[model samples]
Target: MHDESEVAVLRYGHRPGRDDRMTTHVGLTARALGADRVIFPDNASQSEETVEDITGRFGGQFAVERTAALDGTISEWEGVIVHLTMYGERIQDVEAEVRRAHRDEPVLVVVGGEKVPFEVYEAADWNVGVTNQPHSEVAGLAVFLDRLFEGRELEQEWPDADRRVLPQASGKRVVDADAFGDGDDPGGTDADGGANDVTE
Candidate 1:
C-alpha cells in the first residue's frame, strides 16, 4: 500500500502503441513501489482511462491528467517525472519543461525512444533503450523515487544499456520422464533431423 503523499510521474508518450501495456505497467509498478499519487502528462489527443478509473483500480490513489502546459515549478512535487517517449519537433520544449520540473527537486528523467536528440540526451539524468522493459525500468524508477525522497544522489551509475536478454536453455536431454504432465507431449528431436513420434 502507498502512503497518502503524492508522487509526480510525467509520461510524454501519446501514441496508441506508445502508451499501450507499457503505460499500464508503469502505473501499476509505481503504485506497487509506494506512490500515493501519479501525475501523467499526456501531451497528445490519445486518452486512456480517466482519473476516476485510475483511482478506482488503484483504490482512489492516482491521478491522470492531459495537457501541454509546462508552467510552474516542479520542485513542489515530491517524486520524479519520467518521460517514456521523446517528442519530435518540440524536443527543446520538452527538455525545458523537464528542467523546470527538476529545478528545486530531485528529479529523474528517463530518455527512451529513437528520436532522442543530442540536446535532450545532454539534459537527461538517465538514458535507457527500452522503456517498456518492465522489470528493470520499474526497479530503477523505484530506486530513483527512493533516492529523490531521501534527498540523496543515486548511489549507483545511470542505467545506460538496453535490457539484457537471458540465454534460454536448450533442454536437449530429459532429466526425468515421469515429471511430464498427462498430455499429448511432443517428443524430443531425433539425431536424424526429424521429430520423434510418440505412439501408444
Candidate 2:
C-alpha cells in the first residue's frame, strides 16, 4: 500500500512521446514531492503499461487513476495537482472540482506545450512547465506541493509561455537535462558514458 500523504499528480501529455524520458522525469518528481497518486484526467497518448513504467519504480508507491469520477465529491485527498498537456483543452471544470474539494486545500497546475492565455491559468494556486526538458518540467509541481503541505501558497515563475517539444537532433544535442546528471547542458554525457566521444 502507498502512503496517502504524497502529492496527487494528474498527468497530461502526448501518448506518442511516451518513453523512458517521461517516465523517469515523473517518477523522480513524485519521489521528490512525496506524491502517492498519479491521476490521468484525460487519455492523451499513453497506455496502462506506460503509466506503470512511469510510476512503478518508487517501491510501487504511487497509485494510478484514469480519471476523476465522483458526484459532489471533490478534494477527497489533501490536494489536487492538474496537468494540462494540450493547447485547446480548458481547465474550468477541473478547477471547479479542486475548488469544491477543499476551500483551503491548494491547487497546483503544470501546463504542457498547449498555448493557453494567462487568464485561464491565473486562478491556479501555482503553475509550472509541463514541457520543460528533463526533470525540471515537474520541478515546480514538486515545490508547490511542498508549500501546500506546509500550509503555504504557491509562488512560481509561470514562464512567459509554454516551450515546445521538438524532434531529436542528429548530433551533440543535450535533449534531456536529467539524462546527463542534472544540470543545464551537462555536456554530451550519457547515463553510462557510453557515447561521450561523438562530435558536435
Candidate with maximal lDDT: 2
Model 1 TM-score (2 dp): 0.40
- Looking at candidate 2, the ten consecutive residues that score lowest on lDDT are 156-165
lDDT per model vs. reference: 0.39, 0.40
TM-score each candidate: 0.40, 0.40
What's the C-alpha lDDT at position 103 in model 2? 49
lDDT of 1 by residue, 80-191 (tens): 4454332222332344444455555545344232233454444444333222334344454555455334433222211221111112275343211232334322333321
Clashing residue pairs in all predictions, respectively, total 1, 6
Give per-residue lDDT, candidate 2, residue 191. 24
Clashing pairs in 2: 6-34, 7-35, 15-45, 74-101, 75-101, 87-114
**Candidate 1 runs further than 4 Å off:** 1-6, 41-47, 50-54, 69-114, 122-136, 146-200
Q: Which digits, one per residue and each the tens of the lDDT, describe model 2 over residues 90-144? A: 3333434444544444443443423334544443343433333334445545544
